[model samples]
Target: PGPGAYGLPTTIGYEKHDNRKQRMPQYSFGIRTNVSGKDAGPGPGAYQVDKLTRYGKGGGLEYTMAPLTKFKDKGFGPGPGAHDVHLKPMFKGTEAPAYSMAARHNFNFKKCGPGPSAYMYDINNVKQAAPKYSMGIQTKVLGKNNSPGPAAYGAGDLNLRLNRAPEYS
Candidate 1:
């Protein structure tokens, strides 16, 4: 098949003018290469490096109820340089100990329903009430020898009969 049958150019036919112009072709190069390596210069600081370190001198990010008192500071019980042998630690305040306080204080226990104590029955003094009638296996004579009736026979008293043909020797 010719190029006309497939929609492609077999030869340049539209450039038939004799006054065609020519231009110089210029080339530029951009060679790219990736060389992976660690940075020789000092890099950025690690996460949270500027923050307070453990057991640092300056007051750090930690929160405290009160500043630490030095041994020479005053105020532990009017003693020499605030150094007094107290029974309780500083965390325990002047309030009474928990054991000395009244338990379940101001907490009203709601009466949900009638408990066993509210019932008429007394657990410690329980008494068995007598039944209205007696209950037991009756031993009265049903019939002779417990045969249900006098006409009913036991297995030892049964007599079964059988008829047989005369036997040949």
Candidate 2:
């Protein structure tokens, strides 16, 4: 909820080697970690963390995972920054927090089809952002660890979404 006590995040990207193919991006991974002594919250020994992965090659694939606790009821929830607010749902609630994870993969979102000849940002040959047309089959699951809400729930999302590169100009 509140701004992760103190957060540390990292990201990494990768692609196949190709001297003649400069704009061929493959995949990317990211992770986040937070460590706060509670700030007078429920998770003194527990913190929040997030993760995501994106694939630009072969249609499109996306994966996301994040925490889903700190909320007591449907009327109120915690903020993204540090705060002393606490929530205790009177029903259908537990005292523990858990993370939600989802994954999506497909071949209908290659907007660029093959992308332009130029690549956006990259490290060690991996493009930072994928070109247009990055849609596919998606799936999501929340409260997998029996957090405060339902024990575990998930969905199979089938939607075509577009992916585009940012234009500084």
Candidate 3:
């Protein structure tokens, strides 16, 4: 009952049971070495590294960590000195009424930039005698027909048919 009340309480309970069996609580796969001297410069090579080791006790430990979120660019159609060739008739859920037509010659459409191919011309009769070329149409709207003029008269109230028809040999 002298040298630490009994040999330092059995040498501190056998050194805490040998440090709890050498810090038990492990799922280990290891390779660890460290020796630095003689101007250590990769002189004792064994390089091929990828190592992870963990050991736990008593309670807990958990971790988890994720990270690209919208992009659109659908373009191409209008090249070759495009002047006019725009026709849009998209009415799928109703509400498309306002027609007009009378283009027996002069027809125009413009909305340039962005290409793949679209802006065609050449309407039969040898390109309709080539007067800047004509033969392009796009229609929608099923109402309005004020009848009155019809002697080469080209007015508007809405009634232009033909979506795209110009490309003859």
Candidate 4:
């Protein structure tokens, strides 16, 4: 009785009951004639960018200003001008070639294994472990009715912002 249950005697678990009655698929949905009424045109791997031509090797610096042949008659000098003069000692010869940890990536140094030990919380030495002060037993003395007075334990009274009576506008 289980193919499409066409045989009816199903009471073993009554079709595994989730409030059971669902058999409706004897097949009746065929009328879709390949559904395409209109909008799907661009298909040869469609990813269009019409005229965005950025094909490389073409940015700033084409620079033709050699018209300043030695400033073309020097009419612009207000101060330091021989091409701003540094006459050569900007960085000459301290012979710099020494950083070669065997020329770098040779990779062989990791053996330190046993780590985590230095934490010692209190073996008694910060001024002999300090903490002894003692001055706190006053229970409750402001204008002395000695507290526990108002709404003592379930505590709900003083909502004080100057005891709230001020909306007088």
How far is 86's C-alpha from truth in model 3 (Å)? 49
Model 2 spans with C-alpha error above 4 angstroms: 1-127, 145-169
lDDT for each residue of candidate 2 in 1-169, tens digit (9 for 90 to 100): 6787654332323333443434545544765334655454675445332232253234345455876557578447665664634564445633334455855333455564666765566585565556656488665665646445553455434343544556596
lDDT of model number 1: 0.54
* Full-model lDDT, candidate 3: 0.49
Tens-place lDDT digits, model 4, residues 64-92: 75674543455555655556446765456
Error of 1 at 44 (Å): 8.8
For model 2, give the 10-residue run with minimal summed lDDT: 48-57
- 131: Cα error in model 4, Å: 5.8
User: Which residue runs does candidate 3 get wrong by more than 4 Å?
Assistant: 1-5, 8-31, 36-169
Rank by lDDT (best first): 1, 4, 2, 3
Q: Which stretches of candidate 4 lie over 4 Å from their true place?
A: 1-52, 56-115, 121-131, 134-169
For each candidate, the alpha-carbon lDDT, in order, equals 0.54, 0.50, 0.49, 0.54
Q: Considering every candidate listed, which one attains the maximal TM-score?
A: 1
The predictions' CA RMSDs to the true structure, in order, are 29.6, 39.5, 37.9, 25.7
lDDT of 2: 0.50
Score every model by TM-score: 0.18, 0.12, 0.11, 0.14
